[model samples]
Target: MLYDRIGVGYAHGRRTDPRWLAPIVAALGDARTVLDVGAGTGSYEPLDRTVVAVEPSAEMIRQRPPGAAPVLRAVAEALPVRSGAVDAVLALLTVHHWPDWRLGLAELRRVAPLRVVLAYDTRRHADFWLVREYVPEIARLELSRPSAEQIAEELGADEVVPLPVPWDFADGVFPAHWRRPRAYLDERVRRSCSALAQAPPAAVERGMARLRADLDSGRWEREHADLLAAPEWDAGFRLLVSRR
Candidate 1:
């Protein structure tokens, strides 16, 4: 559906950033079987685990690299998985995309004793330079979605950890280029982010035009010199780990 339309070249831009992998794997604990819900291109699936992926987008499924976990063409709201079939359930940066995230969370709980979710906190994202200065529309778009706190509360999370984006984060998700404004100018990079891809064309074009002008005039660098020197930034990503 949405991904099939916008996820054409997803794999090229959304590779697993090892920085993120460590925490996810650690949160998974001793889980031998993991169900990766909305496993886009299977980016963060653990190689050592018995992982089964669930995705609704054929285009995204097609992009899964060779030797990736077996996938079922299913939506998160109604996972085709048995009750307590897996040791853990991992939903990474995908809950917002679900039509009914509550249902998805319920399914995750039903399928495993442990649930790990990576969610976005719009309040924190509002402070990100890109959203603060250029694309306020992205913040508006995220408002209707459940926040990281809400997800944590719904799942009764045992821990809510902040996930900061490294200066050179390998993944091309939104806010990955907080210090590297030039990356947003690239059409490929913008298209890889769902917010940018789904954002109104007029708004995106207007923001990009302003961002380009700011870069050309060195205003961006001058304003964010401190951020340029910083190693990483909290772009509102949070990891919610729950145990039954």
Candidate 2:
């Protein structure tokens, strides 16, 4: 799988962004038991709850910290747990990676009474400046991934919370560094973001060269300086909350 190949160092750049945690935790409500589907490195698995993580990538599972939640090597389409076995289930920024998202979502609904997913609305990908200017290929790839609305409809989501990306967001997802364009130049940053890792090397190189030039020439700053003062920006991320 793509994750098993590039997910070795995922934990280094994929820590939970505390700013976004509030909404996730709140959406989790008072659930006592939770299943973390596609739980890469156990990021965002609530410590307060009994979290059994479901991860398909052994490399990603190996990267989980020592004290992280216990994990089961399984895919979201077929959870080992029985129907309605957990209070809640979480699929954080992972729905797009599922080979069978519809089946995976069905498994989530079957395994728990409540479902929470942090997913991107691909329709809004073009609105992001980085995708628009630097890496148009990311947008092309995003077309294959289901949009947030599609996922919400599949899950019968009662609420879709907008997960605004703070200027200095801690998580290293592709859009997390929107306000800090220079972060894209860092190899470790790109390594952790699936978009850049999966993109054609030639395309990535071309985008990076343009980005580097823009930064060096102050054109990037001049064009996006307004973002520096903004507290946060909406990058089409949404927290889909549903109950069976």
Off by over 4 Å in 2: none
- Model 2, residue 234: distance off in Å is 0.1
Lowest-sum lDDT 10-residue window in model 1? 122-131
The regions of model 1 sitting more than 4 angstroms off are none
lDDT of 1 by residue, 1-244 (tens): 9998899888878989999999999999999999999999988899988999999999999999999999999999999988999999999999989999999999999999999999989777666687778888887777878889899998899999888999999999888998899999998898889988988889889999999999999999999999989999988899999996
Best candidate, lDDT-wise?
Answer: 1
- 153: Cα error in model 1, Å: 0.1
Q: Could you report the Cα RMSD, in angstroms, for every candidate shown?
A: 1.0, 1.1
TM-scores of all models?
A: 0.97, 0.97
Candidate 2, residue 233: how far the Cα is off, in Å: 0.5
